[model samples]
Target: METVRTVCTICPSACGVLVRRQKADIVGIEGDPESPMSKGFLFPKGLSAIEYMRHKDRILYPMKRKGERGKGGWERISWEEALETVTERMGKAKALCGPQSVIMLRGAAKGLPDILLSRLGNAFGSPNITSMGFLCFVPRVYAYNATFGCFLYPDYDYPPATLVLWGVNPSETFPPLFRRILKAKEKGTKLIVVDPRRTESAQIADLWIRPRPSSDILLCLSVIHEVIRRGLYDASFVERWTLGFDRLERHVEGFQPQVTEPYTGVSPEEITAFLGFYTQGPSAIQEGNGIEQSLYTFQMQRALYVLEAITGNIGRPGGKTRWGNPKLVERYGPLFTLQDLIPREVRERRIGAERLAPFAHYALPQAIVQAILDGSGPKVAFIMGGNLLLSWPDSKRTLEALGRLEFICVSDLFLTPTVMMADIVLPAATFLEFDSIHMPPDFTYFAHVQQKVCQVGEARSDVWIVNELAKKLGLKEYFFKDEYELYDEVLKEEGITFEEFRRIGFLLGRKEYRFYEREGFRTKSGKVELWSPDLESYGLDPLPKADPSSLQSDPSYPLLLTSYKPYPFRHSNFRQLDSTRMLHPYPLVLIDGKTAASLGVKDGEWILVETRKGAARAKAKVDDVKERVVVMEHGWWLPEDGTFLDHNINVLTSADPPFARETGTPLLRGVPCRIRRL
Candidate 1:
């Protein structure tokens, strides 16, 4: 038997794992003790990667739809035929309705596919590259980059005097970070968790503030208010290293804790105490994707960044800092590719650019859905590594918009509901079967080479499929011929060979602390802009303030609904895997026991969760939570039962208008909902 060291891409945690395999058969899998970030920690999803790779329903060959779309009928086809048909159809669509009529959509697979798909679309002269970015990390990425000239991430490597986990439970989304927080707690690190639910982290948190849904911006504003009013802010840092502090002070005059308490549901005393602890010393704030799903996501993130800046945490050793190669200069791989391909005319045709241009670079998925429904959108689509029907908001509209596409192709590991609606289904290799690069999504300092362990059936890597399709489309000059060539290209400037990277298993970057002390922040003012001049030019709120949520509730629908993904599952992936499924057997709606009793609903009873848009059935689980908040698990679909809308959470999520003016992200979280016993 031989052991292979690789990183797991099941989630953004990207834990390092050692796979023990004998020839083509696998023995077992365990955490790599030498991994600096994960530090021998592993998630259950990572352990079941082998099962998912070897599952009976794993797509191993290319197939063409044999019946009507969404009928689950397919005929096996050669890779050559699949490539030819896909390219020919894409060409036809582009030629008939211009390049803007073709769309390339991507999902969770980050490293190569995420970058390559946009390049592919732009290389083909389309500007309709869309994903979950409007509802995910893109807003934070843009907000931080605009303010700090780069994405500022929490420094988890160093212990802080205080750590504020805002709207995120590391235990469920980021297990490695969760372990790090636990270790920090052991050393007397003051922990503060700001979430509506009593999460695992909240159980041990020194302070847990449960704000109302869509009220986090208020909480953050109140934190800033208390800090400034109490004169606890770092005066030296603000005057020397930051711009617009004076503007911020005047702007926050009316945002006292007593005034914000009604909007945020946090008392003035609680707000004062939390900020007092947070401002004591070096503190780090870790915001999660839960905060990124609201209609006010961009403003909310900007508010959090302001909070971090006022406390003198920016560019600090134990606070918000960059954690990558400081000396590395050259850009390579897909990052470089994304810049060179798109022409200006095509870029001008982005779907939601009119509304989201200031805050985001890409088109919104909801805009694409609306365009398709109105018969003015892309006629063809190439979906890679995502289940749009199960992952995106409003499964009904996603299906309808996808069904309208003249040509559709889905590349994935399993035959999902999204796959059932495609003209061609390309079988994609798992992470274990592909030698690729893994960059931690949390802005960590290291990168790992995920060496291919073993080939599983006839599945092909996404890079290979993309390269082959580029060749078929006569864009061969744009892509590398092989995955190794791509790897070498990405590492060409690093002074390391691909073989050396594989052998070393990782590449470490020198940590450069207090980066702004010498070079200054790379913003318009060359200082941290507490009140953004860039935002002011666009006539948007320069300072972070609470905006009313897009949706409101009346007497008919009185509860607030927010969606959460379970730890064992990554969006819609791995639900068919028995190993992970055993951990969470059914779709659950988490509500307070008191709320359930008041509504005449019982624990473990089937209930109809209804919103103004739609409704879905979910089993109620009573827990200690805020009475008005109802949390439903996102991406719930059964392969055996094979019903897309019956129990899926997206049925109740709206795909309509009143989106965030900056990011075009619709109201997925903080939606108005109600529940009744079924």
Candidate 2:
């Protein structure tokens, strides 16, 4: 038996893992004790990596649909035939309706595949490459870039005096960060958790501030007001390295804690105490997906950045700090994605680009669906590593839109619901079966080598498939001959081959605090923009503000519905694995005991959750949730039963208008809904 050091790609944590193998069979998977980031911490999902790679239902070869879309019948086909069919369909669509007639869709941003997909779209002169980013972390990315010109990552090395987990339960979503927070807590660092539900993190927090769902912006503004009123803000930093502080102070005048208490569901006294803890010393606020899925995603994130700045948390030890990528490595950006290949006119034609300036070249999923149904969207779609039927909102519409497509191709490890609708399906290798470079997403300044311990039956890496597809589409000059050549080119500046990088295992970038001191923040005025001129230039609000009236209780749909990702899965993955599925036997709708009693719902009883859009059923889990709020699990699909929509929370979600203007982020959270025992 031999053990191979690699990074787990099941989720974005990219935790270091050791895959023990006997010849070609994977024996066990565990956390790498030598990892600098995780430090021997491994979640259940990482531990089940072997089960996922060796699943019986995995698609081992390329296939062509034998009958109508959504039919299970398929015929095994050669890679050459699969490529030819895909190239023919895509090229035909391009010839008849211009290159913009083909759309590329990806799910999670798992390292190189995202870049490769974007590159393929640009090289093909299409500007409609879409991903889950609109509803995920893209809003935060936009807010950070527009406000402070960079991402603010927590400095785990320098434990914060106080850590504020705002709308984030790192305990489930990010175990590595949660472990660090626990260690910091042991060392006398105060912990404050801001979430509507009583999460594991909240239960252990030094202080738990439960605000109303979608009222986080108002809560943040009130906190800022309290901090300013109490003179707890950093006067020195504000005067030296911030812009529009006076406007921000004036803007918060009407949003006092007393005024916002009713709307935010947080008391003035609690807000004061929250401010007291945060302003105690060097602090870090970790924002999560909770705020990113709201109607006010951009404004809410902007408010958080303003809060961090006013508290003097930015660019300090044990506080939020801007980071740079590792030296001599290929950075994932416009240059790497070959953004220049697509002309300005093609980019202008991107769906929803006219309204969302920050959307840039990517298309919104809802807009893409609408365009397809209206005969204006791409006729051919090439989806990589995504299950739109389960992940995207408005499932009925998504299904209809996909049916309207002239041709669809999917690349995945298994035959997912989305794959069921594909004209062709390409087998994709799991992280353990592929050799590639893995980088942690969003502020983790590190890159590592993912070693291929074994290969499954004819499965190929996304990089290999993309390069081969590019070659078939007559774009060979822009792509490498093989995956290794691409890797070598990416590592050229580092003066190391892919083999050498594998031996090195990982490369961590130097973490520099107060980077703005050498050069001011990367904004128009070269300082943190409390009120952004760039936003004004983009025809958006220059300052962040939350409308309390938007939170008024809806009489028609009295209860609020929200969703959370369970610990055992990563957005529609791992449900097929018996080991993981046994841990979470049923999709749960977590409701407060009082609410469940009122709805005549008992524990473990299946209940119908109805929203303005539609309804879905999930098992009732009476828990410590807010009285009028119900939290359902997102990404629910039963592969064993072959029922994808019955339990999917997206069926109860809307992709309608009133989206966040900046990022086109749909309201995936805090939607008005009601429930009934099934």
Candidate 3:
């Protein structure tokens, strides 16, 4: 019998994995059947974990850049030399700037963020720490905090009365959750998928609606207006629990179905009919029905929150609502450095307009890059988990800003395009080979343990690396220790031992429901805040409205471009994996059938995707999936075309600030650009 315990690092899903190892190496990876979260199922990436390790571009040991950055020039070096160089540069940076000048930007790596983020800035006395979340989920978290005073994460197990799958395609991103949706479907629950493209999840849904790109705010506002106009909303709930319903009502009064049809390309009555599924037919329609959406995404999430709240679906078993679970203080990985053990500053110094872009003003990286490149923003950048250059709103300009970083450090598995530019690049252990603990869904309270399977070279867990660096910076005496010792400290607080987590791969307790309690919501007033004090403090309009105000599209930009995550990929990783890469080996642009026909373009041919900032070439995948939608997976390497495709795609994307009112989560899916045949 082979012993194995692993976890998927493919994406944030963090699904529990069970591996079969021979001697000291892993031979196979599968979903842990023992896991209550995954139920023994795995995503494509999880099943092909071994194959990913065998990819061509994998680095086996520590290496230093030997040539000009981004030239793929590297020289293998000892870990001592690597650590020394990283510490030297960081020390010099800490000396020149008041620690606040240095910025730590990390993404997706396991168990290291809190440890590094909390300590790195405070030790240096800087609050400029940011991550890929600065570009992704932080906005959602920010909105949830501002609106409901609690995060109402989508609960797959919650018995929803009417399910609305919007923007997100969890069937690919969260395959395990997809099964939960399927289970709901089996129980005669209605399914509705809303997206700009005819995604796999959308194709199989009971209703699929592809509205105009970037028009989600308008589309949702219409639904709310219709629900209110037809008296479909739960009046008692809105009258009692909501704030600014009157102001919000005034905003949506003029946004009738007919008014939104032109702006959103969604017919008035079809939108009306869709609204009917949840809000009509007396108790038969939604009394116990669920109105769960796939994080609707962008401002769309804000709009969906309104629908759920007005319907009294909130805190109901079968409706969307907020969850409150005990934080997994125990088994949550140890604080790696004494510097990090120091509590972070609670003053919450204003994150400023640029910092607020993802949370407040959507397309912020464009401006953030401009400021950085001009030496106007935070001068030093330390990136940890995420690859921002490849994941920002405008990839092209992000690359340019990356080149201008006075000091940059990245801790990542592979030397990504962005990593190539780092002054210091730390090696990170793969997920299957890390010893850490986490709350799978960051909003929930379940704890999953990630234990090592095989020694993949000498890469260290990020916790170790951050601790090692802090030790060099003379901050070790506080709380930093080798992982096991630190783990013991963390374990002591939770009544869980390392032996317990290692044996079970997780230490779980009885799951608690977020809402549906006999009492009421966990809000300040004990009722969900459709109106809240936080929103008013943030100077945000305290009402959810369909405010789809378009930025003036230049005539030069004739089409709308959006990037979507594919089934077998995460960020920029695994493109080199044979099993996964075969699905769509290279970046291919998708165009609507009508758009292609009109442009004298055919499927599977080279085309030029151009915007004001730049242009790139790609093969076309013409389909009727979306009338005017064109998409390409992000983070494709510069060497993609026969080992060097010049189409970095980022150049053509807009570097403008995001288009959100209170939150600035960039509508990356609705950027403006036109595709032309090569």
Each model's lDDT = 0.82, 0.88, 0.63
Better by TM-score, candidate 3 or 1 = 1
**Could you say which candidate leads in lDDT?**
2
- Please rank every candidate by lDDT, starting with the best: 2, 1, 3
TM-score of 3: 0.89
Tens digits of lDDT, candidate 2, 1-678: 999999988778878999888897878888998887788878888888878888999999999999878979999999999999999999999999988889999988887778888999999989999999888887888889888887779876688999999888989888888888888998889999998899999999989998878989999999998889889999999999999999999999999888998877899999878977898878989999988888788899999999999889999999988766665445556678898888877788788786577534478789999999999867999999899999998999999999999999999999999999999999999998889988766545777899999988899999999999999999998899898888887778778988999899988877779999999998889999999988888788889977788763668899888888887788899899999878888999999999878778899998999988888999999999877888999999999867988999999888888788887878787888999977
What is candidate 1's TM-score against the reference? 0.97
Which stretches of candidate 1 lie above 4 Å from their native place?
326-335, 338-340, 548-551
- My TM-score estimates for the predictions, one after another, are 0.97, 0.98, 0.89
Q: Which candidate has the top score in TM-score? A: 2
Residue 474 accuracy (lDDT) in model 2: 100
State the displacement of the C-alpha of residue 554, model 1, in Å, after optimal TM-score superposition: 2.3
lDDT digits (tens) for residues 1-678 of candidate 3: 496776675666667787888888676777788776688888888887777665555555767777676676778777788778767776777787555546666665344345555465556555555555444555555555555656664445654656777667877777877788789778766777777677777777777787766677677788888888777888887877777677767778888888888767899877866875666311111110011111124345566677777877665556655544433443222343333332344213423453342234222344557767777655666677566766665676677777877767677777677777776666777767667766553535455777777667777777777777767767666545777766655566576676687775765543334443555555556655555555556565555544555523556676777666666777666666667667867677888888899999998898888766677778888865567667765666542432322555555555554445544444555566888777
How far off is residue 668 in model 1, in Å?
Answer: 1.4
